[model samples]
Target chain A: MTLSVALGPDTQEGTRTGTAEATDSLTAPDIPWNLVIWNDPVNLMSYVSYVFQSYFGYSESKANKLMMEVHRKGRSIVAHGSKEQVERHAVAMHGFGLWATVEKASGGPGGNSGKSGGPGQGKGKRG
Target chain B: MLQPEERAGQDPLAALIGLDMDVAEPTDRAVKRLLPNVVKDDGAASLEFRQLTERSLRETKIGALRAAALDLDKDEIVLTPEGAKHWSMALNDVRLVLAERLDIRDEEDAEHVHLMQDWSQAEDVESYLALVYNFATWLQESLVQAMLQSLETRR
Candidate 1:
């Protein structure tokens, strides 16, 4: 029912006949994919943030924010997108020596995604 | 605190969330060779050994604690059979290693080994060396325990 906005021919707004399957396969179901990083003992907190900084090119504050989420909340979803994007982030985290994994996001989890919502607001459910 | 259980074919923490604490393994040759000597039944010996073991886990100061990892699976950390044995035996390892290094009199020190009151005086260089050894042991034990606990949590 909702129209997908497109800037050019590549988007083919109305000519959706051929690409429906492609799009459906590309995007996981209603559930969003997430990259989750678990806390570990060997690596230092600062070091984890530093790796996030160096690998993602995120600023120190941003990296620390994600790292804090992981430390305080037990785990945090560092990235989200299609399955491949989440997988890439998971791999990068592992290469950096942080514990990470991927899983399908739950529907209506009744919590903030940690962006607009504060802590205890968008709590990622423990499974 | 108890070590979190690690389930088969899953991340140790999540699957084994409620299982019994699985002990870690021993890696040092000396620790293995010397475990039997630890006075397992003595309350003071367990306390002294635990203090050093916890300390070792916190800090990698002990040469042997650094080397004595059971094994690491995925992200969950657990002690192996050998590791648990090592942990259980470490008290003896500490006693003997420090006893030899400190030149502690077999008779006098043996009777006083796990007693804090005995070392309060620090009457000789040997006693001082015992204190140092105790410190290193504490660092290693603390780190291992801390690592095991944190990793077992979902974090």
Candidate 2:
């Protein structure tokens, strides 16, 4: 994918340092499914952000924002699209060795209210 | 468990080609981590999804690994962007498998493994594996940092 418009060097460098934390979650109104990247001990934070930037063509700052979310919050909904779109992204993420899962943006019956739930949802850190 | 070998029915070609039509959910936790359910808390749907997609996913990973291996034969390896991407993916996968074997389930476990730096201190299998894992992690991290720089330049 083509890279989007460039930001200042300072903006890119700020993301690389990664001290900033994103308070608001990423959201897409029309997209019905969410692709969530979960935190793991094995994956490097920089590698994870790089995947977000390269694979999805997210801006560096945006990618680092999501990566930090996963690092600090245990998980982050990094992408939103149709079921097929998100599922396809999930497979790509698995290919990259990142733990990812797709879910309906509108939580299903008996599912946790996804919007209100904290980042801890469905974070089953198994062996 | 996702046992392709047993299912390939003694056909070396089938096994070599990774042809398993009736693969089950992986019982091995490490394998499970590698090929996790796409949908959470829904095994039936996840299994169906896996049957449809897991084989190709495995092949994609294997292809990346093969590409990286081929590059290793050259005296001084130089990576095209595609080659670099494949190497990054290959190294990440290696780290994943090693982490599973090392039982690095959380940050604390990872730090414990990271402490195994000295080659002379490799007394047992686990410690040796930890060192390898740390090395892979370091290698991947450096590769990614370089990639990020490239991204910045292109931007």
Candidate 3:
């Protein structure tokens, strides 16, 4: 699956902050945002799992695990880092018949958002 | 109640794979059970809305989660989180049986019939349908609400 895109300055900041030794993140020092997938009714759990597998190329068990997380826990942070990059991810999820939103990673749960609400699909809290 | 196949005395496995009296009951029960939750209407949902979604849930492979390996029963299918989006789009639907087969007749129904016997109970249609009841696009939209609350947990 092509990850949702949420490209922005914050994502760059995060990359820079995380890996001083790494060029990819250090050169792009923005706080990474997250692409969160919330539970929904229309798509089947398996179908959602398939999108993660087929679209994202996640292994079958990994895909099912994510889908199960969404089902059992109500939501799962499928991807993290970079507002602009996460936003792109959000769009891709929407196209595939999944419910997705992008937000700045929270300092707490997601560990990817720079703050509680950064910038992307919605600036609200992670569900 | 539809007669429990007065003809299935031959193959127990075939009989098991085929829809039985057990299957027929849930068609009525599934629609009755899920319609209120899904449509939330006093008036009955249109036949078209009920039929299509029912068929879609039963027959469509769950492309997202890869759990379509479960052969769903009437009670097994309900609107998916995304398919629920069509509810408003299909407001014209008035009354639906929510059965897999379009025809009430047995032969056509038999073609679409899948045996619950081969399925995994943990991921059966019943559980999947339950998830469908809990799922909604609005649930996704409402994550903002959940986000705020989880933030409360942290603080």
Q: For each candidate, report its DockQ versus the true two-chain complex.
A: 0.01, 0.39, 0.02
In the range A18-115, model 3's lDDT, one tens digit per residue, is 34433343233355555667663233443465467555666555566667667656677776566556655554564444656554455335344343
**Per TM-score, what order, best first?**
2, 3, 1
Tens-digit lDDT track of model 2 for B6-49: 44255665455544447678887888888898888888667767
The DockQ-based CAPRI class assigned to model 1 is incorrect
Per-residue lDDT of candidate 3, residues B113-149 (tens digit): 2222223443766544333322322333233223323
Chain B structural similarity (TM-score) per candidate = 0.30, 0.87, 0.20
Indicate the worst ten consecutive residues by lDDT in candidate 2 chain B: B1-10
Q: How high is the CA lDDT of each candidate model?
A: 0.42, 0.74, 0.39
**What is the docking quality class of candidate 3?**
incorrect
lDDT for residue A119 in candidate 2, whole number 0-100:
38
lDDT (10s digit) by residue, model 1, range A20-102: 74345334543366667765322345445545655676554556666766665667666657545665565445333355655
State the interface C-alpha RMSD of candidate 2.
7.7
- Runs in model 2 lying further than 4 Å from the true structure: A1-30, A108-127, B1-21
